[model samples]
Target: MLEILYYLQGHQSVYVGIVGAGIGALAAAIALRRARVAVTVLEAAGELLEIGAEIQMTPNVSVLLQRWDVADVIEDSLVQIEELNMRRKDGTLDGHTDIPVVEKALGRPWWLVHRAHLHEGIAVTAKRLGAAIHTNSRVVSLDHQAGGKVTFDLCRGADGLNSIVRSTLFPDVRPDAKTTNCAYRAVIPYERIRQDSIAKELIQKQTMEVWMGCNAYIITYPISAGELFNLVLSHHRPEKVYATQPDVPTEELRNEYKDFDPRIKCIVDMIHETSRWALLVTGPLKSWSSPQKNVVLMGDAAHSMVNHMAQGAATSMEDGAFLAKCIGAVVQGKLSLRKAITLYEVERMPKAFLKQQVSFLNGAIWRLAHGPKQQARDAAMAPDLEREYHVRSSNIYGDPQTVVDVYGYDVKVHAEEALEHFTNAEKDEYLGTGIVPGLEKYMGWFMKLPANQPHSKL
Candidate 1:
């Protein structure tokens, strides 16, 4: 018993090197740890600093964290929002949806939380599960090999948008400048506006509010257990520039949303700091894996899309889960590493592309300035007192059933099915070899006697 324990401790079922230690990387690490595979996460940053950003954790993503046993660590830090409200720039209600109703159809509650807090939770889970995460160890290059011992390292590219792995894999694939948008992000402390009567009243009740205008829109929600407000504004911008700098002049931000709702402007004025990001689209990769099939891309590296659908992180989380499941199967000898990587791509690309389109459409709808087009959009989303009626009236992007379909996906089951398929193929190959080889000598002898074998004719 002691010898076996020592061996288990000394030997890893598989060695995996994951680049980038963000939500997706950490989640992938933890998922592999659950399968008892040794994982090392290499983050470019020297330390995991608190990025003052907030993200919406839809039911689809929350369910996966729960499955991975890290939900408790983040539950206290999450703001559970039950409602989603959309309004015209003047603050008139355009449409609304009940998050709880969507949650019921999806089987998990939607959460809003600080990006840093969620990262910490995933890091903690990864550590507890025995995955080693190395900070400041950026992988500038990759060296992959197949058919090696279990102890050999398998590279996984969980790197973010500007991924070196992705660039090296497909040089021709570039983000289309026409499809890009610019986002202004801010996370303001609730204390900044607690003194304002209207702002205070607004934050008292948990809700996600989206104010829409011509060619731009704003999404604001409570995060960090309602201690802060997360605001994001995306506008159609043609510049291909990518810049993230703090202390961006307030006037610049205000200029973008100058004609928005007064309340939204008021909230924007309260923001002391902000980051300007050029949101780049990275979906429909020619392939998410290397030709060798020894290295695979996950998360943003695989399919980076705009945040219009509030699914940037959610889809990455799904990528982590699916990739981990496939890699775990390889570690357990259920599938070859190459086969697993192929299955990962086959199972993920179409789904990611669909999500990419939905997100892009959402952005287009939200950014409609004014015209018959905008009017038709408003008419289609005509709200009703009944939640079900309102949801049914909304388009595919806003409909609750779309949420259910996207969130209800179970990648683990799909991974198992993929492994079973390959398993059957492998079995058939082995059986064919065994049966045919046994008849080799007889085949030769029978062929020699078959020149005129009328006696054997049926």
Candidate 2:
């Protein structure tokens, strides 16, 4: 039996034990504390340092951040994306989408910021909201039995990719599968980019640019308030081993994209150091909670997906927001702990799984071979470029429906509606009867409307 290191309020009321102190964990703490739930986070690291490069915050999770009062803290650091440019391999613009117009429709702006700044802001907000955070406390084992000297109403696993909580709960589940694709990340100073005329044009636009080619693509955007430009190069590598190498040879990086546009080559030449990481994604799980319902998973621990859609962080933060909403119902005596967790899994699992598949598919679309199929994709997007109102396109960013589904979603509102449906079903004696009377009608209301529909606006 592993000893639980932290105890809250002598177990007098509902308490949550959270493992891992990443963005998901901190977001959970902030939301739960706002809901008046006691939380204690156990972090494995002795000291939390800056990790990762830039991250995109789509409206789906950005709305939650605003509600939690976190956006204000990191506002200055966030770069509001004005446009997204989709280009061919040689840097010819295939199409572009106006982010401000989309932002106006969605009621939230898509933001780009340094991952470190976002993490720090969430951490500060979590601590300020009265959540206790413990460092150097690695939880090797969790005691799930009740009536222990140290017990929790719930134990949440926000510990990412190699989640001990996920493995401990379902030991028979297979490990996450490594995709054939790998990505190299590098950051160049905006000042250096300004020296090159072609590259300088990129910074001036303040746009997120995606250059696509055969089995490969590059995404670049400004972060840290336009001081640094973040670049990510992703390509298929069937023979490469799956591991994270902090310093891959710069020559290897240049050679991989030697045939790409000269503008891209100029930027690549300036990067002296970069990291290569093998992309891995977890398969869909049957459930995100334990049989006992006291132990649950969130974020990458629940559904780790590739980053092609730039929704990994968005979806992870969305999980934290939705989970907190479900658990908050339990705190308010509106639902039992078991049912609350069930509602969470019921509402979130399918959505996360769909997003995972979409991310994989988006990669395939962006990396199509430079042939007829690629030409068709480019042709499909050409009309949207000239249209005043962008519709469905080969480029996911330009497709208004995908934008609404991915960026315009409001998790909190959806969670509340889910709770309402659950409570109504329970009252109508439809819960245990294997038939939810009003569920179909409720689901119809939940389905996303077309982009042109009035209800599509968040």
Candidate 3:
């Protein structure tokens, strides 16, 4: 039986076992290797095929990608988002935000890339950095016994929503609960979109368009270097849990949005097929690390939230970066493994949970019913649209503070500051309670916003 390995000063390398080869896992592998730790990624799938279509890499994650030397690898594949249009169901523009201006303010570019491209880029980098990736190596059980030859000094779960590592670590925590929402995701070739005059007009500029309606919304953006147009249609669905249907009939999708704007309907009709996914969310766990401190969870395994905020993947990558930073400090003898794990959990868990709540709240705001509340939301956003840059707006994306909090985050600085605070504190106080006193003082600006308190219904 393979036992968990341990690191020694100037001796054996620390072995990190990562389950699931998604973006988070690959990212962690890359960061850990850069920290001089040995990494082995176990992917249950026979191949590393990323299932999703497009993902928005907000500046927060884009910066990390650049730091990991991943941006250049996928440079040609990234489409920079220039503008964002918020519209009503009838395609009437309610507001507009200059994405470039927001990007400028954040000091990084906002990127839209196909999931496959991003995954390939990260995987390539991880492999080049000497991280071993083994597909078809499903981990059915974890042996914590420490007698035999050790294999991994640490284990991280980036296995996504149905993470086996999460289940093994926190069996009593309820599994992910299916939200009353579902999304149909599809991508149409730009060539195909250009054939439709109306659709072609919509894609003439590299912009992301969001059409909001009663209890539903549609988002479209050009991705894959403007070669393809990605569409995400989120709507209320009966409460039910089911497997994702990849080959969802296009007709069914068109029928669902038949009442939308002509341009939207035109684009929907062009989709030959799509995939339906049930939006699921995991409630906050008290701790992301196991009691042994050897096994830990990150990414979707720890805090799976709705995709409304488009931060799921971005935040997952942040987890990888921050976790690697903590572990790096341990390898450097600046901190112990126990303190590193504690700092990782304490510093990351609240922020991730807050993101989960905010994502749900953003969805609620976007899908407000056609009533006074919806009108108020649009009315509140109108003034910000008239300005060159947003100060604050009802639209979460346009809200200046929200934009900064989500996009301006720097994981390296955050980890360094957190490490400093942990190091300065009485070690016994933190290690005994697993709490970093006064850590909330360093929370992102959005943590104090009223919007952070999601509706009770959520």
Candidate 4:
């Protein structure tokens, strides 16, 4: 018997409790509360900072965010770059995909939006919807109990990567990070990269372009409206990722990409300055929710894959929406937290795991580094990847149904389906409860391991 107010103190929500305040946080609060559940938000930092530049939102994520009514928040901050330029060594197009047609066919738009705006929008919306957002209030500790009573303290991992919450929940997975290469992340004024027609079209509208070269990969698109363009320029090297930020110099930015195309090189040269980090990633956490329905990891804390795929934030947000839908359905008597999270993992993990593979392929395409064997393999893959871009983009990529496969179904519809299974799955869930970790038991083999790794020096 916990006192509701005391429980409410330093916390909110009766159903989805003490969750990280990001996509998952908002989804839990908004979705659960909508179904008459109490939820609270806990953020280590106070106030949101829009740090990264343009992010690509695939149709699946957009489908969820639109239902959340926060799409406009991102829509305003985005420049929809529709064209994807696959520049050859000579800087000519190798192939192109029509963004408008893709969007029309998918029944959802592929968008490029500012990472910061999207963060703030979710933060603001969560607060408005009655989720307590503690900014600057770092989570100092976390303890997941056997009885499902998970607890934690704040003011830890507030400086970003050195997260206390991460250290607590995933001690084995905590970062003793290694730096492979350095990337300069910046959002230059539109005036810098907008001179050319292709670049100008990116600034003025929606288009996606990848500037590939022998030793580096620089991808840029519009975000924060046409006024700002986010650019990421990566150069590979052997260096140590300190337990702390290294004393990186601005000259390092210019020095790194000196050999790139004049346009991309200039974008780096004119960066005004740059921000850098040793890219870090962790293996998947297996599952997101804890047994008591009280705690879960979200956003970067859950999984931080390479930027090669361009779906990092989109994937995190999708997790948030799906998790939200899960908690909400359970509160509405449509399912249970255990079953809901199981279903959530069942649906979302496959997509992310697949994206990681596609991203590996895309990275190889950029470095022109796919080895001889892989070159032959890729020669075989071109038609399939292109076919995927053309045919599978509209429906979910897998499952039996053609009208809507597993991947493309609306999150709402999926939530309802999950609920149906939940009611019917009770005996199975009860019987299998000891046999597995809920719905995730069925997804054991769904995550296909990456077949190849990418290296710039290859």
Candidate 5:
């Protein structure tokens, strides 16, 4: 196996083993296959969640989805929102961005999908592409053997989130979820909400209507062939609690967002049940790879975030795609795994960490009162948030230039370049490596993508 690593460094023959089947694993399988690397995927869920909830796929995501031929698959089943309406705590229009038009301006479509459907779509595409998904199987512990092989402890922690894989890769960085508490999510039947003039108006409002209030926020959008509505509400409590087992009842759900507008009320009232879970954020780690094994952390296990900025799912998808490429390169003998992993961390850590922090702050601001900070946020996002009816629609489009730089990046570009750079060490494994890829030929893409150089600790 060690000889395989050396041969892999100079030749092209590598096989990849993945630990999870979420966005990261899916993307990894795609990328690895595209790069011609044999791959396998492992999952911890029984059946994929069929429950529906709205999800946003920014332009960065749109690019990859299109590239993978799954964009059409997802678009066929999701709603393309028209605009984004941001209102003050008192229900005054702060600013709005057009979603449908934004796609046109960016040359890509952004989609608002049912969460479960999106998962199914990805899993289906992955299966069709020959990627394996072993569910009802959990990875209990990781044994980093000497050869390029891994010993997984998959029998013990099989109940999903209490993942053995996560525990093994991040022993010292277990999630401290109590800080912010639960993020309340639910899908309301459209008929129940359409009865209200205001609610109906907002539903057909041709845009998203968001009401920011004291300690809570509610954003409404369409999903599930437009048969259902997607509602995401977040708030804070001194202690952590999940919505599925909330101390409060359905009646109390209305009181939580007490200050929201009437248009939002109809939808909230119609939410008979909510799928609530504790918001867990993992502490930063020194490495995403298990130095002692073949195990690697991906998705929420690596960078969990609140629902703010709607980047959690997107980020997870991006991780899967990038890992596939990285692992493919190593397995194919086109690059060294050690060198590839170094570039992976250098190029991925910064962006993922930023998204993590942004999700945290965005959620925090939403749960805050409608005073000074709200005023400041309204001023900052309004003008940049504005959208026209035809193009630059905030709902249907994204800042691709930004999303690509952050999420659309092809990690292989950097990995290869860093390896060839003269300053790159045979074993040093640092940014000093990026300099060797020859500035003229490959620097352009690196420069275009987000600058995810290593942190002092990463």
Candidate 6:
């Protein structure tokens, strides 16, 4: 492993063009720079601004960021949520889970953080690792061709939902994704909510609560070091909704959940400012990269899914990490860029598609109206208080193994396995062919080790 990294650093001039400065793109930049590859980040925005949104950082995401050494910056502003309480709209406690148990099992803490903090932390780390970030530099065109000798400047397409790179590759595929739901989001300062006797407990307890009900569900948690309360209310939108509308009136938002639990109703009423964001999802793309493999997609551009699983950001982070690892292999002359891109899609697309499907299903189950479906969902979610097992596995929340499968993915380990397998495959190919009669001249520089390269720390 150490030898491989030293070899990768020897080829540090492999230039990579990344099209976006979002979390996934920034992470990719950081990973590539740490591997000693030259990376440039291009952002469409003229200047980075606070997005003013909050996201959940599950154990999987937390662990990856930790491995990359940027976890401290994010951790400083995190609100550690210790439990998840699932309930029906009528305030019936359907089930609950100990977040600490899962955290202990996964070896990392789960947190809810403001998006601004996370973006800033990732940006700082990427710049520190020698990645050049250029804002207001949108990419409008890209072309690539593969031949006897593969040659093209590699470009990473993290340009987000309406990605032009994705459009260039799959022209028949539409950019506007289809969806049946939309969400209203807001953050209430603790100071404002703490004065209200009914809403004060929201600030007092460090727990994430999900209120599941007819045609809608609400999730709330403390963020910004418990300074504010973040709330997201998602509802089925039968009519076609626009991608996003920032000026939605709070009263209109509150009216959508007039029949929710009193607590939820109180939270809705307390929301003085909010915006509606469409939960659009593109089911699955036929391919995650171009035929040339020079341009590859990541994050929402690759797999945009509903947030019911809360794995949107986590999966995007994983994509960046895994893609970085593959690029590292390219840097070491162990894999061609085409092979690395193919391997990335082969391994990541399936998992991403599964998350998309499961998240859609979860949203369906959580937003059931008062009917047979709703009754069945509630009954299945009901807790078995008399069960002899000390550790609960089944409930309104997902099963324990499901939790592990979702939160326990280590991208670094998976990337290492892919590299090893690909390396072995190359050895087998070489053994089978003995030697390529005409390729020795081209392979000379690829096989030669640098004279004074040294292994670096992991």
lDDT of 3 at 358: 70
**Which stretches in model 2 have alpha-carbon errors above 4 Å?**
1-12, 145-149, 427-458
User: Between candidates 5 and 6, which one is better according to TM-score?
Assistant: 6
Query: Which candidate ranks first by lDDT, i.e. highest?
Result: 3
Segments of candidate 1 deviating more than 4 angstroms? 1-12, 50-52, 144-153, 388-398, 421-458
Report the C-alpha lDDT of model 5 over 324-366, residue by residue, as the tens digit. 5655656655555555655556656666776766566555555
Candidate 1 per-residue C-alpha lDDT over 213-329 given as tens digits, one digit per residue, 9 for 90 to 100: 887889999988898888998875555656454667888888888887777788888876677776777758778877766556777777778888878788877877777787677
What are the lDDT figures for the candidates, one per model?
A: 0.68, 0.75, 0.77, 0.51, 0.57, 0.70
Writing each residue's lDDT as its tens digit, candidate 6 over 89-116 gives 8767765677787788788878788989
Q: Tell me the deviation in Å of residue 294 in model 3.
A: 2.2
Q: How accurate is candidate 6 locally (lDDT)?
A: 0.70
By summed lDDT, which 10 consecutive residues of candidate 3 come out lowest?
433-442
Q: Give lDDT tens digits, candidate 3, residues 16-110.
A: 77767888778888888898877778787899988789999988899988888899899999999778999988898877888888888788888
Using alpha carbons, what is the TM-score of model 1? 0.84
Against the true structure, candidate 4 reaches a TM-score of 0.73
Error of 1 at 294 (Å): 1.4
RMSD value for candidate 3: 5.1
In every candidate, how many clashes are there?
1, 0, 1, 25, 32, 0
